[model samples]
Target: MTRCALQAGALYESTSITYTPECLDRLRKAFPGDFDDVDEAMRSFDPASAPAEMLSVLRSFTPARAALPGAAAYFHAKALEAIAALSMRPGPAAPKARREDRELVEQAEAVMSARLSERLTAESIAGELFVSRSRLCEAFRRVRGSGVAETLRKERMDAACRLLSAGGAHIADVARAVGYARSSSFDEAFRREFGCFPAQWRQDAV
Candidate 1:
């Protein structure tokens, strides 16, 4: 996921679970579709349909810097369970339909990721994507579980946090860098988003 796809200061770590050729083949059968690249594969997935167990695992996961003795086997078992659950989804899979839905959301996310430092509105983004404002909002809500504005705000706040952590930049500079028009406006929004003023957050970070 891009920085825009997660909450500010959130870090996602993927565990390395070794699988044999046979296991890899099985997973290939389960997911089935030739993806040109990792991004293509991810773009084809619908996060909304990810099973509750898988979601829970992802949400509660912590980085394992040192591998556990049975970790591979345990992860393999969970993978099989998740694949089984995903496979049981009713009706013949209309992959094309799902891909279309995923693509709409992915495209919007790509645009937002690329332009987070600019003043973006639903209308501006919709116009760039050649979709209506309502349609763009719907796609974001369906896929990202939030509206475009909310995503943009989070991204901006996260970026500000990173900048604050680094230390040295003036608040006004940080405000403009994240697309706010004025430091006072940035201070208000930052307080609302982060529960502290920028200066206080910077002090804590230092």
Candidate 2:
């Protein structure tokens, strides 16, 4: 099987193993830093050998695996490398920034940060940066791989998340603070962006 297929299979299998509270805690803590190590540890784990609670938890966490027919073993190795590297520390050398695009991206990021409460349209940002809307869109897409509206939405959501995590802000207050005039609109947007309602997000964050 290809590396991605193998990794996906491994993830699927590991997710099926019931983890103890201690094991789950360790896995969660280590996952951010060393997913490969966690995967390695889970390789030999058996759900039948685990406590009932752990097995119960595994039932919810485990994903169903699909067969990767016609996948090559070489591709599996490459996928493993990709997955492992995704969780590893950066190597000694950082990649050089693209100076022109970097400058524009920085400017766009700054504008988004500064005007979190403003109804920032792509045209307005393009005008402020002295570029045509299409050029601005291209620059943003080249640098961020997303359009201006998506970036703005991300920034607004980020701001909202921060405010929600602070623990005293009402949903409506946060909605207004992040530029949505109507609370219902903000709630809908928040749900679409984050897959959860603002109140649920706040509770979960807390």
Q: Model 1, 1-206: lDDT tens per residue? A: 32236678988665322335576454433332111012222334465566586565454334361266677666657665554444332322322335555687788777767876676666677799898876766566556655566666777788889999999999998987887766877897788667999999999989
The sequence of per-residue lDDT tens digits that candidate 2 reaches over residues 149-200 is: 6677778889999999998988999987887777877887788668999999
lDDT (Cα) of model 1: 0.62
TM-score of each: 0.51, 0.52
The candidate that achieves the highest lDDT relative to the unseen native structure: 1
Off by over 4 Å in 2: 1-98
RMSD of each: 18.0, 15.4
